[model samples]
Target: MEYSFGPLIDENSKILILGSLPGVRSLAEARYYAHPQNKFWKIIYGAWGKTPDADFDARYRFILGHGLALWDVVKCAEREGSADGSIRNETPNDIPALLAAHPNIRRIIFNGGFAFAKYKKYFGAPAIDYRKVLSTSPACAGRDREREEMWMEALGRSL
Candidate 1:
C-alpha cells in the first residue's frame, strides 16, 4: 500500500524533524508525539519554558513558533504491528519533493537512530555534504531523557 501524509505547517520551514514512523500511541491519538512516556513534549516545553504537560494545540503552537517542521520518514509501511523490525512492503515519503518545496530547510534531524540508519542510504549525497543532518533526538527511545534534552537544545539551535 502507498501511504501518504498530510502537509504539516508549510514548506518554508527552516528546521525539519523526521521520525521513522508513528508508534501505536501516536497513531491511536492521531497526533504526533502523543505518547505520554515519549519525552518529545516535555523536551519541547522545557526548551521553550512552557508547562511540560501542555495539550496538543499548545505543543503544536510551540513547534510552529520555533519554526520547526515535524513529520515521519515513512507515511505507512506494512508490519505485524508497531515494531520497526516488522516494517515491510516499504513505502517512503517523498523527501525529494519536500526538499524541493522547502529550500529554506537548512537542517534535518532524525528523531532516532532507527530513522537515520533506515534512510541514510537513501540520502544519496556525498558523505561530507550530508552534514545537513545536524543531530538525532533521544525522545525516540524512551530511555534517555538527558540525551533527549541535549538533542532538543541542538534542535532549538537549528532554528
Candidate 2:
C-alpha cells in the first residue's frame, strides 16, 4: 500500500485543496507536488501574487501562510504507477474529521476530476461548498496559464 503524507493544515486555514493521491515524485521527496513538471506550486503562487519557491520548506510555508490546506483524497492505495487511473484498493482520507477539526475551512477544492470523483464516492457531497479545478500534474494536457486561470477563478469564488 502507498501511504499519503499528512495534511498541511492549521486552525486558520480556510481553503482546503485536495489531490487524488501523491505521485511517485512527491512521495520520494516527502513533499506535495514535488514533481518537477507539476504546475501546482506555480498556479498557487500566481494566485497569491508570489513567485514559486525553489526550496520545499519555503513553498510549504508559503501555502500555509496563505491559509490554504493541502492534502490528498486517498490515504492509502494500491497502484502500479503514479497515474490516478492506476489507483485501486484505496482507502480514503477521513475528511469529515478534518472538517470537524478545522472549522474555519469553508471551501474544499478538488485538484482534478479524479480527486473530485473519489471524494464524492467516498464522502458524498460535503456540507460545505466545493470547486473542482483541473489537475496541475504534468500528465494532464493543458496550457499552464489556462489552468492557472481556472484555478484562480475557482479560488476567487471560494474566497
Candidate 3:
C-alpha cells in the first residue's frame, strides 16, 4: 500500500486542496508536488503574488498562513509508479473527520480529475462547494498557463 502524508491543515484553513495521491517523487521526498515539473507550487505562489519558495518548511508556512490546506483524497492505494491511472484498491482519507475538525473550511478544490472522481466515489459531494482544476502533474498534458489561470480563478484572493 502506498500511504499519503498527513494533511497540511489547521483550524483556520478556509480552502482545502485535494490530490488523488502523491507521485513517487513526492512520496520519496516526503513533500507534496516534489516533482520538479509539477506546477502546483508555481500556480499557488503566483496566485498569492509571490515566488515559490524552495524551502519546504517555508512553503508549508505559506500555505497555512494563507488559510489553505493540502491533502490527498486517497489515504492508501495499490499502484505502480506515480500515475493516477494506476491507482487501485484505494482507501479514502477521513475527509469528514477533517471537516469536523476544521469547520472553517468553506471550499474544496480537487487538483485533478482523478481526485475528483475518487472523492465522488468514496465521499460523495460535500455540503460545501467544490471546484476541479487540471492536474498539475507532469504527466498531465495541458498548458501550464491555462492551468494557472484556472487555479487563479478558483482561488482568487482567498489564498
Candidate 4:
C-alpha cells in the first residue's frame, strides 16, 4: 500500500490545501510537491508575488506564515502509480479530527477533483464551502495561467 504524507498544518493555519495523495517523487523525497515539474510551490509563492525558495524549510515557513496548511485526503491506498485514477482500497485521513483540532482553519482548497470528490465521499459537505484548484502535477495538461489564477482566486487574499 502507498502511504501519504502527514499534514503541514498548525495552530496558525487558516486555509487547508488538500491533495489526493503525494506523487511517487514526493513520497520518495518525503516532501510535498517534490516532483520537479509540479507547480505547487510556484503558484503558492507567486500568489504573494514571491519566488519559491529552493530551501524547503523556507517554503514550509512561508506556507504557515501565510496562514496556509497542506494535507491529503487519502492516508494510504493501493495504487499502480501517482495517477488518482489508479487509486483503490483507499483509507481516508481523519479530516474531521484535524478540523476540530484546528478551529482556525476556515477554508479548504482541494488540489484537484480527486481531492474534492474523495473528501465528499469521506466527510460529506460541511458548513465551509468547497473550493478547488487544478492539479499541479506535471501529468495534468492545462494552461498555467489558468491554474495560477485558480489558486489566487481560491486563496482570496494574502492571508
Residue lDDT tens for model 4, 1-159? 999888999899999999998989899999999998999999899888999999998999999999999999999999987899999999999999999999998889999989999999999885675587898888777678888888889987535
Error of 1 at 157 (Å): 2.8
| Order of models, best TM-score first | 3, 4, 2, 1
TM-score of 3: 0.96
**Residue clash pairs of candidate 2:** none
- lDDT tens string, model 2, 41-152? 9889988688898998998888888889999999999988799999999999998999999999999989999999999898898789788888999888656777788899
**Where does candidate 3 clash, by residue pair?**
none
> For residue 63, what is the lDDT in candidate 4?
94
Q: Residues 14-116, candidate 3: write the lDDT tens digits.
A: 9999999999999999999999899899888888689999999999999998999999999999999999999999999999999999999999989988999
> Which pairs clash inside model 4?
none
Q: Give the Cα-based TM-score of candidate 1 against the true structure.
A: 0.78
Taking every candidate in turn, the Cα RMSD to the unseen true structure, in Å, is 3.6, 1.1, 1.1, 1.1
Q: How much does candidate 4 score in TM-score?
A: 0.96
Give the per-residue Cα lDDT of candidate 4 at 154.
92
